[model samples]
Each structure stands twice: as structure tokens, then as C-alpha cells.
Target: MKKINPHTGILVALAVIACWFASLFFLLNWHFNWSNPLVYLMVFVQMHLYTGLFITAHDAMHGTISPNKKANNFIGYLVVFLYAGFFYNRLYAKHHQHHHHVHTEKDPDFAPHGFWKWYFSFMLNYVTIIQLVIMAIAYNLLKIWVDEKNLLLFWVLPSLLSTFQLFYFGTYLPHKGEHDNEYHSTTLQKNHFIAFITCYFFGYHLEHHQKPGMPWWQLYKVKE
Candidate 1:
């Protein structure tokens, strides 16, 4: 069995959720100041938080968030919904398919096309009309109280950018090229800080595929 701090997943989940909401609240209330460097910084900050939200949900899908199935799934459902109106059950099934079929045609995440084509195909797997409708509804409702600019820049834009951040570091790079390894996955050079900053250690893609039970925070320990 893989050694792990069972408490870490839930704790990290709570931290990511709390930070996402807090940053969103602050940004929604904030006056826009392009002249201010903090305005720019906060975009990246919120983008990272958005990625963190998905990472939390991903961990939950693996049942790493808690030993209790209900708690684990609850956290998964919560974070994915918070991320972008994603359905936990839908993602759960698709993700398992991803693992089982991997890079094969049956894999929901597999796209043999170039980056842009692959990205759109990847987005299609999870992005639904329902999600778009939910986002539209939420935007209209929230804009009544919040500035539209702040909502777009801080909320919508960051979330969109985070998709690129996630797809590039986590999916595109790791699985783009052929690999001789059993998992058919590529990992980054062993730089723990780079791994974490890139995608919460998801850059260690081969290690993750090998030990799907391991949580994101613990990937570095196993990188060796």
C-alpha cells in the first residue's frame, strides 16, 4: 500500500474551496484598476485557484479526499460544481473510462489531433449546454450586484484561462508524444516546485498514472 497522510486530501480540498470563494468575493467587490499591478496578479491568482478547484475534484474522484465514500464523493461533487457547473457523476464515469481505455479511441479524453483541435475535442467531453446555461444564468444574476467587468475578468476569464493551464500542463504535455512506458505517459524532469506550480504536481504525470491512489500533494515524495 502507498503511504499517505489520509487527512491531507480533505484539508487541501477545504483550503482550495475557501480560497477560491474568498478571492472571488474580494475580486467581485474590487474596483478595476488596470494601472495597479495587483489587478493583473489577482487574475493569475484566481486562475490558479480555479485549477485548484478542479484538482480537488479530481482527487475526490479517486477517493483520495476521504476514506468514507460518501464524504469523498460529496467533496468531488462540490468542487466540480464550484469549478464550472461540472456534474460529478458524469465526470466520474468519464474519468474512469479515461483510465481504463487510456490513450485508445475509447478514452473520452483522448484526442489525436493537434493542440487546438485536441483541446476543443477535450472540452466537448465535459462542456455541456447545461453548463453554458448555468454559467449564463449565474452571470446575469450575479451582475445585478457585481460589476460586469469584474465578474468577467476575475470570474469568467480566470476560469477559462485555468482550462488552458490544466490542459497544457496536465493533459497535453504528458500524453502528447509516444512513450515506451507501460502507462504511455510522460513525466516532467524532477523539479518539485515546477511540478507543483505547473499543475499541483500533475506534471508528474507518469507517477500519477502509476499510483492513482496518491493525492496531488504527495506526488513529489514518490517522484524519486
Candidate 2:
């Protein structure tokens, strides 16, 4: 399982990224009815691919993407950059602080106030000069080959949606409010399908805190 998980992880990460941009390519080129609602529906589906990309990076932060540290970090950086501008080391540090100091001021993800506040805080903390430069380069390079609308809807907008998805399901909903448990995490949605759809079973967040070393795919299986 250990060996297969890393191999599988990289493949899955690449697959999600391909799904997002490839679908966007097709969607942008295809002439569709102006009022077609399914267009938005499909865009939201592509947003799931964005969510998957970030989730893969999150797994890499936990060092579960591969047994080989270098390979894991490589894949993590690729998928995260593909998602949008983000510094892996910065995210890693903040996430570790979150786990170690959950619900406290020191917890980078402290969300006692509510969901929106936490989401913005999380997003703001991930940005840095290096990340901005990387994003700018990516934007210029992608614009050379991709349509502006496609880039916004598929690459940029979806990445934005993915942030709310990650924070709402992965952090705020899980760790909000007063909880007496050691981890202070919650299982807001126990339905397996909902958990899977929302954020790759991250809705079972207490299980995550209970088993930090476990991969996101296996979080739901934990007896939280």
C-alpha cells in the first residue's frame, strides 16, 4: 500500500489537472447556446478538478504523496502551481502550525469567528512575493497559448472556488465553534458521498485530526 499510494497519488494529481484544463479547452472551443445553464454546471465540475489539485498538494505536505521526499515535493509543487500561485514551503509551515496549535491564536487557521473570515485569512496567508512572481509568469506563459476567458474560468476562477471549497470543508466547518474534544474538529457531513464530493472526504475532518498521518482518501475510513 505504501509504494502504490505514492505512485497512485502522482497519477491522480496529474489526472485532475489534465481534467480541468482539457475540459476547459473543449468548453471554450465548443460553440454553445448563450443561455445554456449546463455550461456553468460543467465549469463547477471542473472546479472539482481544481480542488483535487490542491488536495494532492495537501497530501504532499503531509509527505504521503511518495516515500521519496524529493519526488513527493516535485509533484506537490507542480500540482499546486498548476492550481494557482502558492508557495509549498509556506503552506507547509502554516498547516503544521495549525495542527500543533489548533483553536488558538497561534493556529494559523484559527476560525472561532466564522467561515468567511477564516477563508480570507487562509488565502491571505498563503500569498508571498515569490508566489506572486510565479503566478505572473504562469499567467503570461498561459496567455500565449490559452484564451483569456478560458484562463479565467478554468485556471484562475476555479482556483478561487477551490480556496473556499478547501477552507469551508477542510478547515472552517471542521474546526469552528467550541468543542471539548482534543482535536476540536467536527464531522459536519457524515454522508460518504457528500464528504467525498465536497473535499475528498475532508468533511470527515475530526478523523483527520485524529489521524494526521493518514491520507485524505483514507480519512473517511478512520473510526472518528
Top-TM-score structure, candidate number: 1
How many collisions per candidate? Answer: 0, 0
Top candidate, metric lDDT = 1
Error of 1 at 119 (Å): 0.3
Tens-digit lDDT string for candidate 2 (1-224): 23245577666666776876688678656565548888678778877878988888888898877778998899787877777767677788888998899889888888556566777777777777887798888888878877777667656776778788888888877887888899987785568788888999888888888877777776776744
Candidate 1: tens digits of C-alpha lDDT, residues 26-88: 999998778999999999999999999999989988999999899899999998998999899
Q: TM-score per candidate, in order?
A: 0.97, 0.88
Candidate 2 TM-score to native:
0.88
Q: Candidate 1: where is the Cα deviation over 4 Å?
A: 1-3
Q: Candidate 2 — which residues are off by over 4 angstroms?
A: 1-6
